[model samples]
Target: MKAFIVAVVAAIGLAVAAMYALTSNQRFAYQAFATTGARVSEPGTNLVGEKWTGDPNTNDKSESAHGKATGEPSHPKRS
Candidate 1:
């Protein structure tokens, strides 16, 4: 009986987690999970062209501090 109760509790916890992930910002959640710690990139395997460095809409140079070479903003600013 105790095992059954524990199983039910675990199932409920999973359901709640799923619901939260569905309702919350999935991209930021994924980013938080991915980059919350010191991430090591394998040499020659870095995809700088596919990241914010390649994003033309971002002007923030912070990506370099994180190890990326940035370019100009692809989108024009609004007045």
Candidate 2:
């Protein structure tokens, strides 16, 4: 009887896990599994044609900034 009960419990847990995996919500396991979504020029290798320069739209010279380069001041004009 005890063995049968344990088996039933295990089956239920497995079913719940399967349902979770099928959910649309992105989870840690799914994100970590994919290193990069960008297409690769060659299979089994990660090589880029050119290094990323800076955003053309932004005045900031840095490669990455907090927000988009809208060419506008973030703060409002002071009185």
Candidate 3:
């Protein structure tokens, strides 16, 4: 009984650690695009005019263009 309990606890701990790593490792594509200035277009979504911090010159034109075309709302808009 004691060994079974320990095994269960270890399994639970491993599961929790795996969950944390998965969530932390998963990167938001939109956020990445925004940061790198990479033009990312979805079929249904219109994410144009998004302003990013990185190099303006090196940043993709489509991305920057979208940023300019739109109001360039601040990402993760501050309250």
Count of clashes, each model: 2, 0, 2
Residue-by-residue lDDT tens digits, candidate 1, 1-79: 9999999999999999999999664442223444434333321224433243644344333345333322332342386
lDDT of 1: 0.47
Better of 2 and 3 by lDDT: 3
Ten-residue stretch with the least lDDT total in model 3: 42-51
lDDT of 3 by residue, 30-77 (tens): 544654355454211444322334344434455434324244433442
* lDDT by candidate, in order shown: 0.47, 0.42, 0.51
Stretches of candidate 1 above 4 Å error?
Answer: 26-79
Candidate 3 segments whose C-alpha is farther than 4 A from its true place: 33-71, 74-79
For candidate 2, the C-alpha RMSD (Å) to the true structure equals 17.0
| Candidate 3 or 2, higher TM-score | 3
Candidate 2 lDDT, 22-71, residue by residue in tens: 86364333233534542222211112211223333332344553332233
RMSD of 3: 12.8
The best candidate by lDDT is 3
- Lowest summed lDDT across 10 adjacent residues in model 2 is found at 42-51
- Model 3, position 42, has a per-residue lDDT of 25
Query: Which portions of model 2 miss their true places by more than 4 Å?
Result: 25-79
Pairs of residues clashing in candidate 1: 56-73, 56-74
